[model samples]
Target: MVDPSPESVELARFSLWRSKLDCAFGWFEDAERTIESLLSPQAQNQPETLPFMIFIEPHLPRMEGLELLHLLRSHPSTQALPVVMFATSYDETDAARSRAAGASDYIVKPVDAREFMQVVSDTVARWLPVGSKKAD
Candidate 1:
């Protein structure tokens, strides 16, 4: 769920970074508009789905979207979903506050390819079901 810029190149790069997974993309012009869409009825009911790890770009235009993390955490339907936020920069205090607000984790942007891969892999690994094994 780590949405960078809407650039296709960025999306492709991210896709390539985790090519082995059954990855799908969800888009919303704003986070608030997308929460329900991303967590559609079908998606929520999937039995084999992995723990959701969202990478949100909080720097964009919609401030309400930023409130999405709190809203998701507050709602029972999405309360346990693991979310990871990505941003180019944030004041340390601001980042700390975001954590307090309920983001599972945060990643600073301009991430190198290697680090990006590792982070995504590690996050997915940590969040995956306990008896599950990594996809080959």
Candidate 2:
């Protein structure tokens, strides 16, 4: 997750936990750190250690989510990774930009806690293997 908001990270963590999905979540405050970690020697040596998906907020402190998405797409190591761009409200322009930048999906975060949790769980499940318990 590349959101600086602690609440958002906690919410996503809780949602995944409630759904009984076993995923190692890494929360980064900015795109630079995330990029560094993802491009590190360890991660490059063992690609399986990379995340199954990435959740990013459109507006971040440093680099914008769309910019980060472009960077990820430009890199060979992260080109195929699934990146989901999200925001507090629906914006057609942002959604279109995300899609153009190669984001796997785009979502407008739900206000209701339950709905948010459901959305997060469902999104993650979509990226998991069909028969995996994580997807169930």
User: Which one is best on TM-score?
Assistant: 2
Residue pair clashes in candidate 1: 1-55, 2-55
lDDT of 1 by residue, 18-114 (tens): 6555545455556645555645676457624534556666664655335777767876667777776666675586577678888877766545656
Candidate 2 lands at a TM-score of: 0.92
User: Candidate 1: what lDDT?
Assistant: 0.61
Candidate 2: where is the Cα deviation over 4 Å? 134-136
Tens-digit lDDT track for model 2 on 48-106? 87887899999988799898899888877889989999787889999998998899999
Clashes of 1: 2
For candidate 1, the TM-score is 0.69
TM-score of each: 0.69, 0.92
How does model 2 fare in lDDT?
Answer: 0.87
Q: Backbone clashes per model, in order? A: 2, 0
